[model samples]
Target: MRYKGFVIFTLFLFNIITIKPKAIDEKDSLYIDNCKRDLLVLMMAYSDEIRDIEVSEDNYIYLVLNNNKKIIYDDKKEKNKNAKILDADIQDTLEDIYPLDSINSVLEGMDPGRGRSYTFLNSIYGGNQNEIEKNLDFFSTYCGNIMFNKKAKAGEALKNALNEAKELADKDNRVNNYIFPISGSYNYRVIQDTGRLSPHAYGIAIDLNRNDSDYWKWVDKSKGSKRIEEYPKELVKVFENNGFIWGGKWEHFDILHFEYRPEIILKSKFFGDTSKSNNKKWYEGAPLNDEIENIINIINSKL
Candidate 1:
């Protein structure tokens, strides 16, 4: 695998320099440049094995690998839900962003605008469903039994985080209601209303106590007043600290949903937005080398 990456990267290096940068508004240009650098920096933080990165004339950021495969940094497509991260109104820090205050006062988490990038995530887990399925493992928690991607090593991280949250719930009655029996994880499917793939498809997202949870879709969309009165904020802190982002934070409000997105957490801490990730060391969960290699292979195949 390493040899494949080296060969592909060597062949592609010369090709990238020939592709001129796109012409856009000065402000947009600066944003795109920052996005490009951040995307490369973030990939490197996770694994230094990434061969190369380049911004195209169309503003797509490509992460090139040795096997000649590539993953789009952020497609920035009208249809790409995750591409919204480049333009979403996100906060600077986890605390400030998830602020358990009145929903009306907060706008940062309202629209995660960013949806999960399938190719990018596939790189991290496995490129296809069969590959990803091989990495699936089950864990039992106070909430219930759940399945998740063991390759990402986040499943273990979440189990640990849940232990801490369980301790907190034991001490506080209110916290007990936050996580009832879990709904699910690792379902291979596109989002219900869109062609976009879901984080659940990668086995990184979990939906908690469906009965207690409130989804925006359950209510009238035009009314526009959805208030969260029962989500345990302390429990949320535990998940975020472990690299999970709560759906409760989004304006769409899927109170029971939480997905692993360490990049977003790290981005909030350093740049206050998920736009830039330069110079940050990966100090989050322990990522296995084999898994990282699988991710690289996916990137190369796509490139």
Candidate 2:
């Protein structure tokens, strides 16, 4: 009887050990469901924007959006509008414009915009699905960079660049110098003639402390070719590390402007080193300015 009782007790313990929870914890289950829902939304958004999707080995998709007709229309419009009547004879006077055949040939070889390209590639190239989903939030939220100035698919590149920027900003203390909202997109304009969409439209760009910055439009063109100065090197460095390029680098500069143009930066070989090219460095052995010191002190006190 004693042996039988012992055997029964052992079996009961084994049964308890083998038993699984009958239901998932409600909070955890809810979180998982929400994540899945968010991912679905992101995938749907991408699908809606692009076509010709083929999965790559890396899990990114290669897709194309048709734009050849639009380019051809633009070319023809320019040519027809510029035909001039000189000495009673109508002459086609636009010198440098390419022939329609050339434009068509070029368009035929070009890929669709960067956003679509990256999305398709990413989908097929296959990284962590959860990580990709998180990136959707990062892109959709405009967490790191502004969107491109046009509706073309390259907007996805801006989103990816912004994500890289956010990661860098979180690591750097100089980011505290500005109190701008690092997340969410802003509305801004592109050069009117460029026919490009503003990056902010795609929800990827951030503008900081407009009051402190200078813009070329604010300056008188009659002033004879003056350049709008850039923000401090420290600030520019923080931005560049996150895959942004400063407008201060442009001849038509907007000092407060920083956009996610990682492709440009990468192709231009402008890595994030914003220190003075000379031996003199802005932050090296230099005392923090009164404003910066005060800000630092306040931050330290809080800590």
Candidate 3:
């Protein structure tokens, strides 16, 4: 009986020593997992433009574009929110997770998808004003002539979103007030009080009918919060479902603004919910097929 007991204990101890912990935090921890997640999301989001990823000797990751241009994933710099908005890395831009569910109140100190990565933008979209203008095609909406980028289907997405919104307006008269009289789109202008080019400058953002209480700068938090709640949820939903992020959800709320940011939306859709504790793979919830599986393999092996 003592011999048997000793063998059993030895086996148990060996098993405990040999069994590996799950790769829950593979590289660094949640940070590495998040980096991989963001990279994969970007891959799935812009599959047409992003060709492959490059890992450097010093351990820098880059998104290799079809045009042979490479954009760094993270500079490993420490920057405040304002600094990030001005000059942001892909990491910094995607750090703030945008909530998909409707919000009656404003987000505090976080504007997911608000910070513009000019390096990434200029790579996918046009670089200079002239180059960007060349990619522009005037899109006709109830908001009048709004110019949108032809590259990356920015124009098509905007058209589809507005067309759906128009159908919604047809059924619900209340939606019309918010859909019509769009403020502007495709203006090659810097944001007021800042040198950063507006998302509108990229022809990816559309501003709906103006309200004095629509913007954070224009009104206090009380009024902005009221405007958000008062705004038609369906209208916002329509835009979001069509690959847009609502400015009303931002800390620096621009209630009338909706920008086409598929990467942000993809992350929200695929990795938003934390209830999937049963997931064996990190990329479990995302739609899987040939290309995505291939990307997943590459990410797992590389990252």
Candidate 4:
């Protein structure tokens, strides 16, 4: 009986020793997990351009932008005639509110390595790789300090926009279609030893269908000027509803690019398919308007 008691006591001590380290490991893992979630929220709230997010074992997150392939912008395109000049008043307002030095700091900080990135102007204006780099560098220096400080409102707005976009996409039978992920803070990128802050750094940008996209840079220079005619209106509407601006709206035209620049989109009055004044209407009509309404209804019925 004495020997049995001693064995039992020794076994209990061993179990406690083993369980303590396991508990500590579990606690450490949970701490790391929570830290990552907080950082992700911060990044998503800051920029809308990030797509394809991956979290690694080491706690680093990898993100890539859905930048469209570069293509030529044809001057003779019908849309060019309709392209409204960006509001001068808004431009002036932005200039006054976000000075050149501030823009520069944001750009400089975005670069992961060297401080230069390519920026091609409208194809009609003639392509100059060197000139694009210079302009981007200058712009970065000018607007570097314009930090997006409105967190709670921005997050709420973004979530609302995402839900609206998802509903619209479902209605249009494009539910499986890639919706741009817009939320996240901007980060600097260093590629090929050149540094330039991608618009994605702002967390309000998204790109879709990288495989089927056209970009100005991908256009054959020999063609002189050729504009890609395809534009993803359904996708654009989703973005616009969420207060994002499409790259297709720009003369340089990146059809797949969407950025969170509510100030510009709102000023342009390009609300896409989402009505600003009828937000409540949108919410009520969402399930009805989409093809997935039946599925959603069935799920609700079960509940």
Top TM-score: which candidate number?
3
TM-score against native, each model? 0.65, 0.33, 0.87, 0.35
lDDT of 2 by residue, 1-303 (tens): 999999999999877666534234544444333222222222223333333233345433223323211101011123332122111110121111111110101122211111212222233222333433333333353343343332223355555444554555577644444425543344434444554444443334556655433455666432212222222355565555444565555444444556654333332232123222433322222235664344334323322
* Model 2 root mean square deviation, Cα atoms: 25.5
Q: Is candidate 3 or candidate 4 better by lDDT?
A: 3
**Local error of candidate 1 at residue 92 (angstroms):** 17
Which 10-residue window of candidate 3 scores lowest in summed lDDT? 19-28
C-alpha lDDT of all candidate models, in order = 0.60, 0.36, 0.85, 0.36
- Residues 1-303, candidate 3: write the lDDT tens digits: 999999999999877766544343343556777788889989987888998898899999999999999999999888987888778999887877788888898888888888878999888888989888898998887556778987777788898888888888989899888876778888999998987889888888888889899999998998899988889898888888878899998899999999988888888888887334643567867898999899999888888
Q: How accurate is candidate 1 locally (lDDT)?
A: 0.60
* Shift in Å, residue 249, candidate 2: 1.1
- 23: Cα error in model 3, Å: 13
The weakest ten consecutive residues by lDDT in model 2 span 67-76
**Candidate 4 residues 1-303, lDDT tens each?**
999999999999999999989999967654343333322322233233323344445534333333432321111222221121221111121111111110101121111111111221121111243322222211111112222213223334445555666566667644334443322233333212224336444333445444233343554422212222333355556556565555544333444555554443332331223322432322232324343344234323322
Candidate 3 Cα misplacement greater than 4 A, ranges: 1-27, 142-145, 274-279
Q: Candidate 3: what lDDT?
A: 0.85
How much does candidate 1 score in TM-score? 0.65
- Residue-level lDDT tens digits of model 1 in 1-303: 999999999879856665433334545645544453344335633453356666578756676655556766654434333445432221111223333233432244445524445556667677778988888888776666678888546688678778988898889977766576667788998777877677788898888767423666775432323335445667778887787777766766677788887666644544454333443333222234765555444444433
Candidate 4 TM-score to native: 0.35
lDDT ranking from best candidate downward = 3, 1, 2, 4
